[model samples]
Target: MQKLRGALIGCGFFAVNQMHAWNDVEGAVIVAICDRDPERLAAVGDQFGIARRYADAAQMFADGGFDFVDIATTVQSHRALVELAAAHKVPAICQKPFARTLSDAKAMVAACRTASIPLMVHENFRWQPPIQAVRKALDAGAIGEPFWGRFSFRSGFDVFSGQPYLAEGERFIIEDLGIHTLDIARYILGDVKSLTARTLRVNPKIKGEDVATILLDHEAGATSIVDVSYATKLGTEPFPETLVELDGTEGTIRLSQGYRLEINNAAGTTVTDVSPKLLSWASRPWHNIQESVFAIQQHWSERLRDGGETSTSGADNLKTFALVEAAYESAASGSPVEIGALL
Candidate 1:
């Protein structure tokens, strides 16, 4: 297997983990790194031991001769950079939200399709060990036939300390943070028939809503209530927790507040913690989607080498982006919106 020489376009806060993950990947190596900020670029380059560095994406793409490019930049720049990668005939693994708008996401997918290059958006929340475990549990019928489920992320994790731009963005949880949760719901459940969402701006300073509650109507007749909040300020260790509770006809499972699950039926009560946990980065209870970098990067490397699509391809992620758009429309119109209409 040929090792894919990689180039990271952004050396911002989260890029650090992606770089580290690339180094850890068996058949991939980050040959080049680029960032507008020299100081941050130098710091990341020095830490990662990469010799090739560029201040611009074009120069990096031209000079590095990378097999694949990692666009870990912001949402606003994803389309242009990803298009640049496609033009360069380099497979791209970009960071999420795939783009600021659904149209931009569609354009990115089309551009990559036109160029015959693989385009993957790094939507890694569902790849996290705990979420993956929940996925496995659901598949194994540990929670029986999942009729309903909730994907909740309530935290005051001070995410702005690193990415301050999120504090000022016009899109809130559903588009930004909740986007991952909504996609997880879709992955665990199925295609959404329609959805009604209400957004709340608890934080006065930010332009977007700090909290949102989404009512999802899946095609399989499962009703899911997805709640996402960046304003949860609990004075406890479990303050910033992701709550996932699913109830089926035969059993029920819950994960949150120290992760307790209970199942009751003729088979007797089965109660235990179903939380899929891993080593925390920086602080405990790592909630950032960035935590799944290793999983996402490994998947990217395998797909890039084996000639397959990523776990979160731009085209596949269209459904996820549609959910975000529908949430916004539903919130604005105070009505349930059809997922297909957004497409």
Candidate 2:
């Protein structure tokens, strides 16, 4: 198959993993990379062997013969950059926290839809190796019919070291980190029909809530609780680990910390480790995220080759977006929010 030439805009922390994945992906090539910072541009460009580098996305988009553009900039710049990309008729893959707000996200999605171009959100948490392994088991009926589940992430890892901007941001864990965990719940169970959320700004120094508990009612009769926190001091628990508890009609599946898969049913309890292959970027607590970047890139490559669809398409991510809005609203009103009404 032919490789799809692409340009990566934004040479931020997460963008590094994408560059690595793009190298190994069969049907994709990074012909150009753009970053406002010339230092980042030169560094990532040289490392990836991408000769074409630009300080501006428009210049890169105009000059580079790329089939698509990957926008990995901050959430605040997403709408403008994506709008420009859509105007150029370039299919786009945007990093998540789709936009700063629902209206902006709607505009970006609407623009791409009107231009008849594929626009997908890069929501890659569930694609993490061990996470995918759990997803596969659920699909294979190892956990029978799923009825309940929880996705939890807690840690005090210095996430601000690389993305120091996160520490000074207006929004914290929910929109920043919680989005991934919430999307994971939606991925495993299904679209949320209703949700009740409680959020806390445990760390008063920053603006957004650092701790959140979300209760979701999935359309498929599955109930899920997703909790995320960046305030949890790491003593015994490692940095940023998502613990999943899945209860099915006839059995149960517990996937967390390493690759343990426990199945409890009438046939007695059986345990297995069906973790997915780790990516080169995977290490320590960030391994899941690293593996995810690779898997999602491969998923993108496969879709391009086979004319398939991305799991995190703009239309699909609208649901995840609704959950974010509801979380904030619920936090304000101190009550449960119905997700279906948002659509």
Q: Which candidate ranks first by TM-score, i.e. highest? A: 2
Per-candidate Cα RMSD to the true structure, in Å, reads 2.1, 1.6
TM-score, per-candidate, Cα-based: 0.93, 0.95
**Model 1 Cα lDDT, one tens digit per residue, 1-343:** 6788888988998888787677667889888989999998999999988889888988877775789899989887898999999888899988989998899999999999999999888888878766776677678777577899898888877777777888888886777788888888888888899999999999887888989999999989999989988888877645444678788877776665765655555577766665544534433555334447777888888888789878789998999899999999999999999988788
- The Cα RMSD of model 2 versus the native structure comes to 1.6
Total backbone collisions for each predicted model: 0, 0
- In the range 190-260, model 2's lDDT, one tens digit per residue, is 89988888988777666667899988989999889999888888657655567889999888888766567
Candidate 1 ranges with C-alpha deviation above 4 Å: 237-240, 259-266, 271-283, 287-291
Candidate 2 Cα errors over 4 Å, as ranges = 274-278
Superposed Cα RMSD, model 1: 2.1
